[model samples]
Each structure stands twice: as C-alpha cells, then as structure tokens.
Target: MNPKDWSVSQTLMHAAKIYGEKEALFDLKRRMTYQELDTESGRLAAGLKELGVARGDRIGICLPNWNETVVLFFAAAKIGATLVPFNPMYRSHEIEYILENSKPHVLFISRAFEKQVSLSQAASLVHHVIAVRFKHKGMLSYSEIIDRNEKEMVREPIDVDEDVFCILYTSGTTGMPKGVMTVHRSVVQCAFTVSEEMHCNENDVFIVPAPLFHIFGITCNVMTAIASGARMILLEKYHPKTVLQLIEKEQVTVHQGVPTMFLKELDQEDFINYDLSTLRTGMVGAAPISPEQVQKIRKEMNFELCQSFGITETGSVTITRHDDDEKTITETVGRPLPGITVNIVDENRKPLPPGEVGEIAVYSFGNMKGYYQMPEKTREVLDDEGWFYTGDLGILDEKGNVRFVGRQKELIIRGGLNIYPQEIEAVLLKHPEISEAAVIGLPDDVLGERACAVIQLKPERSCTEDDIKQYVAERIATYKVPENILFSSEFPVTASGKIQKGKLKEQVLEHINA
Candidate 1:
C-alpha cells in the first residue's frame, strides 16, 4: 500500500500482519508484541464505539507513557475519534482550560494525578471520565470498558484519509494553550519523514524519554517506530539511572530526547558502568543546545547525534542527518525535509537573503490543518500563501542550514541595540564552570530592557559573578554582555524539558522586589 494513502489504523494493522509476534512496545511494567498491540487496540476501538464514541467524536487522553497509552492512540485513530492528549503533569487550571476548549466527550486520565487535577469542573462537558489505574466513585474504569467481550469486533468504515486524527495543545509559553488540529495525512507524512531521515528499520530498537503527549514523542518516536516496524521502549517517568539501565537492558539503539535528558544521563556518576555500545544514532532537540553538550554527546555517547527544529504545528521541519559532520550537526538544524520548504523572512513577510537573521517560515505537508476553533489565532501565524510564520528568529546559511537565534519575544532591546538571548547564553555556556545557562531580558527604566544571565554551575565548581561577566565581555560587544548574573540550582522547565524563560523572568522580578 502507498504510505500516503494509509491511515494510522491501516499502518498499525499492516505492521501487525507483517511483523506479527515481533516485540513492539516495552514499558517496564509489561510488554506487547505487534499482534497483541493491534488486537488490544482494536478491542479499545470497539469499546469506545460501544460507548457511542463515533467518528468525529473528541476524546481526551491524559496519561503517561504506558502500554495503554499506545493502545488508546491507535484505537482513537481506528474509530476516527479526534484524540486530544494532555500533559499528565498539567495542573487544575491548565487542564480545565483545555477541557473547556476541546470539550472531549470522554477523558482518560491517570489515577496518579487524582490529587493534582480536579476534573469535577469539566463534568458539564465530559460525559465520562475514565480512570486508568484507580477507581473513583463517579468515574468509569479503563479495564471495564475494554473487558466487554468485544475484543475482535471491527470498527465501521470511515474516511480515514480526510478525518481529523488528533488535536495536540501547544505548551502555551505565552498564554492559554491552543489546540493544533492535525489530520492523518500530516501524521503519515511526518512518520515517513522521520523514518527515512533516521534510517529506521525493523531491527532498530527505539527508546523514547520524552513524554508521549508531545509531538516529539508521538510522531518522531512512536509513529516513526510503528512505520518502520521497530521495537519501542517507553519510559513512564524519567530517572537518569533507570534510563541508563534500560539502554543496557533493552540494548536501545536509537535514543531521542531533549538536551537536558542527555545532560542528566551524561552527568551520572556511574555513566561508564552502563553498556551503551549498541547506541548508534539519536536526536537532541526541543530546546537550545550548547555546542559543548553536542560534542560531549557524540564523543562520549558514541552516537551520530542529530539536531532538529520543529513546532507542534509542523513536525520535524528540519533535521541534521546522522552522516553530517560534527560542526554542521552542532552548528545548524540541517536543511528542510524533502517535501518541506523553509525561508527566512523579515517583519514585512518578504524572504530574506541567506545569512541574514529573520523569522523562520515553514511550508510543508506536515503543517497542522489549523488551530482548533481558533481562526484568528491560526491566521496570526499561518499566512494566506500557505506559509507558517514560526515566531522563532533564525538564519538560513548559504548551504541552507538553519541557525536558530532566539524567540522573537525573547529578543532584548537595550536602548537601541537588539540582543539575542541565545548569543549571550552560548557565550556563558562556553565557560568551563557554567554547566547550563539561560539569558532573559529584565525591565529597565532607562534602557527599556537589560539582559540578565541565570546559570547552573558544574558540580563542585564556583566562579565569581565578576569573572563570569568578564568572560562574555571579552567575546561579545560590551552592550550585549549581561548586566546582572545570578546562580540557580535549577531552572523552571516544561514537561517536554524546555526552560521556562517567562517563569525565570518572574523569579528575577520577585528577587528584586524582595
């Protein structure tokens, strides 16, 4: 079958027939082969159907990475339900906002978050709230729904090619989360892009540390592995030691995660104790990466490390190939994927020359249909010409490589000069004592904004604030250097492992007020 014509359900069914008893998923608690995954997922689809969840119905899945999460993903696709996945770590307000916006008829939540999130408020919209592990007085149980003796029943036929597959809510760094409407065609294209670029095969064992709710986990890891008929090891929770143990135990060949995940594993005191020789390639993205971090990953982890640039709207827009040299891999997010076109555009939306920094715009099949029920929000970024103006600032090199500068909102204007946080952060990371660094613009009465550096030092290492400022001053312009330097034991981060710059800015403000 032509891959483009196949829906996610068809793809999984095809894999089940071809791979059969091949191990498909591992979650520490249990394992499922392709056949079992397919059968169980079908059962789930039937169960959902029994509950009146027909095509076009919205279902919310708020669970961690587990065997059931995988089954629910395929089941939703099979039944033509639009799955809206929520980060399991989201608090009450965050969860309520999404629930109110998406209005999924059924919400599948993990019992573990019973204390953190209050779903009672969403009772007006959600007819049934299915708890995964534990049972509550009023909520339904996942096992009860799936054990209805409807395991082998097939779902009714629907137009899978044009139906909405899922709705993924953005991380909402700026404001309330917006749902990105994604169809099966975009997902299939993203899967093919990842499989081809990463050279995935049946023999490959993919290990994913990113949360399943994120696009990186769903498309780049889960869907990509399914497309290639590869084995996938899912981690319910991230512990650097446990992840290292899994790599040795499962003989994980392909590991994909954010830079912080890689750094935590590398910083382990007994990192050398693990047998990571099987690792051949992986990706480190979803956040800014220091060149030092990239170098350490390649030389120490002994893998052909890759970097990428993508957003929830478009999956894997650009990725540095495994065969690329260390400099190219570390320096830029490689040229756009085969079918994706990228351009650096100025404020006026005119394309810019190579080497000039501007807004990164992407045009691709992987682009989302639009933000769900948000025509105004969708039109703000996606232009009439089919271009998605990625609010991120970047530069396309002469070789078509993309160098990410910083978010447009993160740009600091000191008097009349524009200072990018990434440039200052990069200079700080070059300091041997600084392990991780983040730069943010702070309020200044005279300058409009002044740059401040927040840093986490290497273990048992210390450097005076003056010495740190001197290091950056020696390399960049005097105006670009951070006016204030502060030490942090850790930076506030999102579930997907991105440093929360807005939260960090608030921390600075609080400190000044105190």
Candidate 2:
C-alpha cells in the first residue's frame, strides 16, 4: 500500500507483519518485539473500548517516555481515538488549562504526578482518570486494563484522512494553550517522508531522549521509527552519562536531541571512553546547533548531525540530507522537504529576496488541521490558503535553505523546550509584591538560553529571587521558571509606554557582563 493511504494504526500492523520478531523497543529494561508490541497494544485498544472510548473520543496522556506510552500510542490509534499528550513537567495549573481545553474523556497519567497535581482539579474536566506506574484508590489501573485475553482488536471502519488522531497543546503568544489538531494522513505522510529523507530502515537503532509528548518525540521520532520499522532505546529522562552508556550499549545508530543534550554528552568527563562508532546520522534541533558542535558530533561522536526547523503547527518541513555539507548542515535548517513550500516575508507579509531575514511562513500537507475549538486563534496564524505565518524569523537562501535567525516574539528555548516570555511574565504579575515584570531569554553556554525575569516592586513590597522562583515553580512547570531574577525600579519602554524587551535584554546582558 502507498504510504499516504496508511493510517498511524495501519503503520503498526504493517511493521508487525513484516518484522514480527524484530526487537522494536528497548524501554527501560523491558524488551518487546514488533509482534508483542502489536499484540499488547491491541489488548489496550480493547480495554479502552471497554471503558467506552469510541472512535473520535479524545484520550489524554501525561506520562514520561515509558514502554506504556509507546503501547498507548498505537492503542489510541487502533481504536481511532485522538491522543492528547501533555508534558509530564506541567504542573496543576498548566495541566488544568490544557485538560479543560482539550476535554479528553480518558486521561492516563503517572502516579508520581498525583502529589504535584491535584487530580481533583481535573476531576471535573476529565471523564475518567487512569493511573500508570502506580496503583491508586478510586482510579483505574493501566495493568488491569491491558492484562486480559485479547488479540487484534476488531476496529470499526472509518475515514482515515478525516479522522484526527492527535491533539498537541502548545502555548500561544497570549499565554493560553492551544490544541494543535493533526489528522492521520499528515502524520503518516510526514513519517514516511522523514523515513525516506533520513534513509532510516529496520537496521537503524535510535535513542529517544526527547519527551514523547513533544513534537520532536512524536512525529519525528516515534512515528518515523514506526514507519521505518527501526528499533528504539527509550530514556526515562535525559542523563548525559546514561545516554552515552545507552548509545554504546545498544549500538544506537541515530541519536536525536537538542543542543543541550549533545553538549552535555560531548562534555561528559569520560566522553571518549564510549564506543559510539555505530552512530551514522541523526537530527539536532529545537535549540541552536553551533558549527563547532556539528564538527564535534561528526568527528568525535561519529555521526552526520542534521539540523531541521519545524513547529508543532507544521511537521518538520525542512531537514538536512546526509549528503549535505557540514556548512549547510550547521548554517541552514536544510532545503524544504518534498511538497513543502517555505518563504520569508517582510512585516507587510510580502515575500522577501533570498537571504533576507523575515517571518518564516510554511505551506505544507504537514500543517495542522486546525487548533481544536479555537477557530479565531487558529485564523490568526494559519490562513485560508493553508500557509502558516510562523512568528519565527529566518532567511530563505537562494538554494532554498532556511537559516533561522530568531523569533519575532519573545520565545525562550532553554534546551529544546519552547517557552514564551509572556507566559512567565503573566506568572510574575500574579505575584503579590510585583507590579510590572518582563521575562527575556539570556544567552547561556549550556542549554542555549535561560529565562531572566526583571521586575519592579509594588510600592515597598519585597520578595527574594527564590521566593519568585518558588512562586512560578508552583504555578507552572519548573523548567519554565526564570532561572535568573532581578529587581528593577524602572524598565525600558517605548514612547507609548510598552516595555521594550529588546532594550531590556540589552541592559540585562550589559549588567551581567560588567
């Protein structure tokens, strides 16, 4: 069958039939083959069906990169339900916003989150809450659901193209979370394209350090691996030592992560001791990948590290091919993928000449179906012609390569996570002592950038940096909390009285450097 006709669920069946005995996943210490994964996932689909999860029902998962997540992915697709994944790092406030917005019928969450997140906050939002990893009273069990006599699930026939399989919630400029809806066709086609572009095959064994909930882990890592029948070594969390050990232990050929991960691994004290010779090609994106880092990855790590530029709104549209030169791989995000149209535009939205920095806009089949229940917000970015006006600034070179400059909006990419300044600013404003606040990304040697919050007190009110960090940490993901906090009596503003972040960033950097 043509790849376009294959749904996410169909992809699994094909993998199982063709590579039944091939080791599909090396998750934690558990080993599962293609056939076992397919079988267990089918049992999970039956259990979900037993729980009244029908086609089109939305299922939410807030778990880490465990074997269950891999099983649940195909399980949701097999039953034709939309899987809404939440970052496990999200606290109650962040989780509640997305939980209320997506309104999933069933939520499979980790028990570890039970203490941090008050499930009662989600009691009204979600229909059912199932606990994974730990057993809890008054909650359904993941083990109970799947531990049953079941084979391939008899799924009801449906329109694959029309059915939405995943709804990814990404924070918007306004600090509100918007659910990005993606249909099966886009995901399958994108995965097929990624497999073809990366030349991935059954022989490829990759390690996923990126979270499964994130776009990089979902479409680019998980779906692509499934499409190509490649083996995966999943990590619970990113640890430089463990990652290096796994790469050598599993003979991981393709490694995908952000600049921070690569830097950490390369900077490990015993970095040279590992046998990473099996490494061939992989992607390094989400944060800046310096030219020097690219060379290190090639010479030291023994892989042609590729760079790709993409957003959750549109799947990876530009990716560096293996044949591309080191300069192209380091400097540009690569030429546009097949069937993707990208252009740089000025403020007026007119196309700019090659090499001119402007807002990067993308038109591709990989573009999201739309933001769920957010037509007005969706219209703001995605136009009628399917061109997504990405707020990111970049330059489309004459060779059709995309060179990312910076974000038009204040987006702080610490490690590989995208964080909006406005979101942190909103949290800072919520502080009882703070009158006005601004959050900006500061250049960092590691993690690419870190958030710094500069604030003014309300009259004589006072709060230490730890107080502010603790406040924000309790409200949102700890990763989104400002690493550096500064108190200021005044802030740089425009003539109209809006805080000028550009000037604020300049002043902050000057103060730090001095």
Residues 1-514, candidate 1: write the lDDT tens digits.
5785678888889999999999999988888999999998888888888788878989999899998999999998888898999888888889888888998989898876666666666566588888897888877788887888466547545454458888999888888999998888778778877788988899999998889889899988999999999999999989999989989999998999999899899989999999999997887778988777788888999988899999889888999997777788988978798889999999999999998989999998878889999999999999887799889999998888999999999999999899999999888888989889999999899999999999999989999899998999999999999999999999999899999999999998999889
lDDT of all predictions: 0.88, 0.83
Which whole-number lDDT from 0 to 100 does residue 309 have in model 2? Answer: 86
Q: Pick the candidate with the highest TM-score.
A: 1
What is the Cα-based TM-score of model 1? 0.97
TM-score for each candidate, following the candidate numbering: 0.97, 0.81
* Candidate 2 local lDDT, 280-317, one digit each (tens): 88888765454655677678887878899888889788
Clashing pairs in 2: none
lDDT of 2 at 4: 66
